[model samples]
Target: MAPLRLSLACWDYDRVKAIEDGRVRPEGIELTFLNLRVEETFFRQLRYKEFDISELSLSSYVLTLNDPEPPFIALPVFPSRMFRHQSIYVNLKAGIHSPSDLAGRRVGTPEFQMTAPVWQRGILEDEYGLNYDSPQYFTGNVEPSTTERTEKVPLQLAETVKIQPIPKGKCLAQMLADGEIDALESATAPSTFGTHPDVGRLFPNAKEVEQDYFKRTGIFPIMHVIAVKRSVLRENPWVARSLTKAFASSLEYAYEAIHARGALRYILPWMQFHVEETQAALCSEGNDKWWQDGLTPQNIRTLDKFLEYSFKQGLAKKKWEVKELFAPGSLDAFVL
Candidate 1:
């Protein structure tokens, strides 16, 4: 039988570099990898089902689960995860010195349903006692925009919350710099902050804050998950395990490259130091596998918390079990 051929769309992350370079191949499969921006991939994949497999926003993915017939089902191979404390940006003049100060302030997000904003908002509300509906939320691009961006998924906002688009030709970054919006939360750093001195992160010592958060909550905030089109999965159910195995192997390759101390593969001079720091911060006392795959206890705990937040924030109609989020074949190891 001929090997299955599939198109896979995802960002150029180190963890998936082995798969991209053809060093790791899925069993009985040939892949054409589309290296693209995360937003473009998610938009195309979610809106058009443009690829056989693609990276999806966790928040957006949860929204789709509410649909009676979702077009995609995911594997547990998370391509992107990060601590979102640093995602919150604020104008120095906004009088928002702390997360609590965000209450009753105007906040902007690139998309209402984006994963980064959802994590940040959830953390703020849960840890700092900020009400979910306290802020007047604005949705749009982060740069000097030509037009406002719209939500990719419908939202059921709290009755106390008010959300509107930024005026045409306006954007979140420009609004924050001008004090039109008190703050903005996004996965990417706002472009205006690089040029404007007045714009600063809400948590200046974000690393320390994030480390504390992880220590307390044990969540590394999953941003994007790998999903296969339901039609493709239905035709070749074995493809799920094959793809998961390949991705897990690819992550091992990434670990080797990052931990190769003889010659640093990454650009940063302190790349090894950063890796060691990350391991120390996130790993158990004697274990260093901080980024393990395959729905481990830690990952499941994180996913459950995320689902709780998603449901509470109205991105998900109801709380979904972690097993329901991934293909059945992906939940356990297959004996060879």
Candidate 2:
């Protein structure tokens, strides 16, 4: 039989670059990797079901699970994981000195259902005492000068959760900088973040704060996961296992690239020092430090926490179990 041909739409990140560049190939699959920007990829994939496989926002994926006939089946392989404490940007003019100061503040986000904002909202609620509904929300592109944006997945939030959009031709970065919004939560910094003296991070020392959060919670929040369309998955179940194993191999290759030390794998001059420190901090009892993708206990706990956030925040249509989100046996390893 001919190799299975599939087009995968995802960002070109180091962890999955091997597959993108053909250094790692999924068995029996003729892969066509489309290295699209995350925003474009997500918008196209979610809005139109435009690709055979895609890297989907975790929060958006959860909401889609509520669909009567969900169109996609996810693999436990996370293409992107981020700790979101650093995502909170505040206008200094708002006098927001701490997380508690955010209560009743006007906040802007690209979307209420974006995974980064979901993680940040959860952090504010769980780590601090701020409720998810504490802030009045505005949604718009961080720097969209003309085009309007919409939620990737349809949302039916609780009535108490109030959210609206920025004015047409307006942007979140400008809104925050102008003090129209007290704070902004997004995966990418608003355009005015470092350039505008009036805008600063709510947690200036977000690195230390996030590390402490990990030490306490063991959750490096997951942002994006790989998913295949339900039609494709039902026809070829082996595709799930094939893609999972390929991603695992690619991730290990990335780890080795960083560990090689013969040449700097990343741009940072102190990359090795930080890598070693991260490993020491997160890898007690021999865990992988770079947040490996799989359905291991650590990942399960993390995913479960996100599910709770989704359900409580009214992002999910119903309370969802973690196992319900992924393809059967996709996270398993076959010993050779």
- Model 2: how far is 82 from its true place, Å? 0.8
lDDT tens digits, residues 1-336, model 2? 999999999998889999998999999899999999998888888889999999999988888888899998899889898888888999998989989999999999999999999989988999899999988999988997567987878788888888998889899999899999999999998889889999999999998998898889888889999999999988898899999899989988788788878898778999989888988777877566556777877889999999999999988877788889999858565333
lDDT to native, each model: 0.89, 0.89
- Which residue pairs does candidate 2 place in steric collision? none
Per-residue CA lDDT of candidate 1, range 1-336, in tens?
999999999987999999999999999999999999988898888788899999999999989988889888999988999999987999999888889999888999998789998888899999999977788899898887565578887777777668888888887888898889999989999888869988999999999999999999899889989999889989899999999999999999988988888886878999978888999999998788888777888999999999998888877988899999999887764334
Q: Among all windows of ten consecutive residues in candidate 1, which has the lowest summed lDDT?
A: 327-336
TM-score of 1: 0.97
Q: Considering only N, C-alpha and C atoms within 3 Å, which residue pairs clash in candidate 1? A: none
Give candidate 1's error at residue 218 in angstroms.
0.9
Q: Give residue 246's error in model 1 in angstroms.
A: 0.4
